[model samples]
Target: MKQWLRFLGPLAILAIAAFLLRDKMPFLAEGYQQVLDANNVGLVLALIVTIGSMFAMAEVMRLLLMAGGTKVSLWKTAELTFVANAWSSTFPGGAAISTVYQYQTMRKWDVSVIVSSWFIVVSGVLSTLWLVGLGIVSILFLGASFSIWPLLGSATVMLGIAVLVYLATTHPKATSRIICSEVRTFNRLMRRDPERWIPAIRKHVRQLHAVHLPRRRFALIAALSLANWMLEILGLWLCIWAVTGALPGLERVGENPSFLGVILAFVTAKIVGTAQVTPAGLGPVEAAMTASLVAVGMTASSAFGAVFVYRILAFALMTILGWIIYLISVARGGMKAGEQS
Candidate 1:
């Protein structure tokens, strides 16, 4: 009975929502039909490109592990990436949950705690750097007509943090001393014990010192991270194209939908969704992306339709796939290399 109730709870809410929105049923139906009628080729290409973006990220992770002197296979990393992504996008506090999940899985694969931690931190840094890089390029391509000081400020801040991280990773001893001093000062001000934290910090710093990546490998990882974002952007563009192709007499802002416009929408949606109030920013991300698309000259309905299709592919499908992989991995006794059931 409990299992049945759990399964039916969402259905009941959805049914209630449908009843409440009954008056809008026709409009919703039309949008659904339009999505169904979207260009098949474009839809297929969007799926491919979106999955490619996932693979790109997985490759970054695999490369990071290799740089840390761990030899996890590409396939295992890809599986882990999907599973981690699903966790991150599927629940409240998902990012933390996903990090813990990844760390545990990496440990199971014989990865050192320091190297595993490095992979997570550095991958995130690289991804953010490239996301800001894309935003900057989009602003330039769009003629900088809009006020962009905020974007520039954000870019500068992210770059500064990246440089600091690089320095810390390369000069662990100096970084440790500085960090310890700051911790000691804070502890003294708070009338707390500094000895307890300082030794742990030094130990972690020593572990971190062993997990350095060479410059060339770091650059390759950075490039792969950039590719991951760009491919997802392409997937969004394809979704827009597919929706527009399906909806007859849809009015676009320009001669056609602008790639620059798509980039802006993508960037804006990402920024808004960073809060992750919902799983994968489900509601907020869809709302922000739809609004951003409309601001870029798409009609509200068209924009919503495009965003719906994009999210269906990128978020919904990916989450489902990731869950399936997670279940399979569990049944197979985790993702340990060469360990058979």
Candidate 2:
């Protein structure tokens, strides 16, 4: 009964989300037909790119885990990433849901709390920083003047995190002491036994600090992270082209949207959609994406057409894929494979 209840919350949220976004159903329907009628070759290429993006993300997790000295097979990493993305994208506050799932799942591979926490935090920070970097490049490519402050701020945060991680490595004992102290304080406030938690916290932190990857490995992960975003951007571009028949440098009658414009629109929608107020940022993402496309010179109708198709191909289709894996994994065992072990 408890296991079943865990599934109900996301189902309810998805039902409500679908109901709320009924206004876009018409566009979604049209977009569905548009994709169906697109050139066979172009459609196939877009699907391939979209599929690659999923694997690229899975690789990010694998690399992060490897860096932390947790040796897991790539297949397992991909499975976990698929489930995490599916879980997180399915409900409100899914990020937290996904984080908890990932932590629990990694524990099966003997990943300690400190290492798992570092993997989550570092992967998230790197991915966000990578997105901001892409956004900056997209802004520049659009040949429009925009404030650089946000990019600067994000870069600063990324650098700060790197420095802190390095400092923790250099002084693991001190770092563990500080973190364990905070955990004990919080535990005390919650009327828990600080004595019971502090040792475990310190041990995990010290272990986490000891497993640092080389600079070369770090660079490779960074490259993989950026490639993941680029592949996703390519998926967006292909969707727009499929809808409007507009390539990067090609001019058409009444619809000549540049590839850079679509790229910019993609970045903007992502930034706006991270809130996850609705399941997978349903209404807000489509609205913001359509508006940004229009701002970048596509007609409003064409903009909506493009965004509708993109979301269908990217979010909706991926969600379906994730759920299929989710069901299979759950039936094979449970949320964490180690539980079966």
Candidate 3:
């Protein structure tokens, strides 16, 4: 009963959200029609680039696993990527749920807990660093008068995390001792047995010492991560082109929307979407990206149309495909070797 409730909870919330936003459905439908009326070539190109973005992300995961001394194939990583993305983007608290799902799935691939944890952490850190890099680039390109303090603060936090990870990996014994001590104190406060968790913590910490990221591998992973973001941005640019071509009036608003404008809008949408107040940051991301596009001189309708098309490819289409992959994997008995594992 509890399992059923857990699965149904997010669906109920999503349905309610749809109900509350029912009035906007027609507006969104109109945007969808505009996209369909646009040049088919641009739509196809946007889809191809969006897919390439996902593939790049999967490659990053595969490389991170390799850095952790695991040899999972790209196809397997890609499968996990799509499935995990479905979990992360569609449910309440989806990001955390997706992390847990990926960890468990990797365990089935014979990945050790430590290596899997390392891959998750390192990949996340790399992604954050690159996102900040994008923000920096956008600011430079657009010369927008936005404050830089937030970006600096984010960079500082990432640096601190990187330093701590480095210390933990290089000085495993000391880190283990510190962690176990904290665990013992917490267990005592909770009237629990330290013996239950300390051994596991110590073992995992010890395994961290074996995780070494080579410079070349790290560079490649960084490049892939960057490529992933770039391709998504390119997809958005293509969507804008499609919308402008379809609606000639949009040309009056902005003759040639600069690529830098799209970058600015993409970064803004990403930052706003981190709130995750809605499933996959649905409402806030669309609002932010559309507003940003309008701020960059696009007509509101055209901006909304482009954003709608981009979301269809990036969020809706990908989510549907991911769920299909997830169901197929389950039907095949959970990603085993010789299947889509």
lDDT of 3 by residue, 1-341 (tens): 45335444554665576456646765545555676687788989999999899899999988777666677778778888888887878865679989999999988887789888878887888788788888888777777777878987997898788778768877899999999999999998999987669888998998886677777877898899999999999999899888878332222334445777788889889988887766678777888998888877776667878987898788878887888898898998887522225
State TM-scores per candidate.
0.85, 0.82, 0.83
What CA RMSD would you report for each candidate? 4.1, 5.0, 4.8
Give the poorly placed runs of model 3, Cα more than 4 Å off. 1-33, 181-196, 246-255, 337-341
Q: Model 1, residue 29: displacement in angstroms?
A: 4.5
Alpha-carbon runs more than 4 Å astray in model 2 = 1-36, 143-147, 177-198, 250-254, 335-341
The segments of candidate 1 whose C-alpha lies over 4 angstroms from its true place after superposition are 1-30, 143-147, 184-194, 197-199, 246-255, 338-341
Instruction: Kindly list the per-residue Cα lDDT of model 1 for residues 165-261, writing each as its tens digit.
Output: 7788788899899999999999989999876589888887777666658889888888889899989999998887898773212233552557777
Which of 2 and 3 is the better model by lDDT?
3
Clashes of each: 0, 0, 0
lDDT of each: 0.78, 0.74, 0.79
Q: What is the lDDT of residue 274 in candidate 2?
A: 83
Tens digit of per-residue lDDT, candidate 2, span 1-341: 44334444544664576456747766544544565666656556777888787788777777777777776766777788877877877786678898998999898778877778888877887888888887887787776566778877988898789779767866788898888888888988999988767777667777866467788988888888888888888887787777767664532235566666666777778877889886677778888888877777876656776676677677777776777888898898764432211
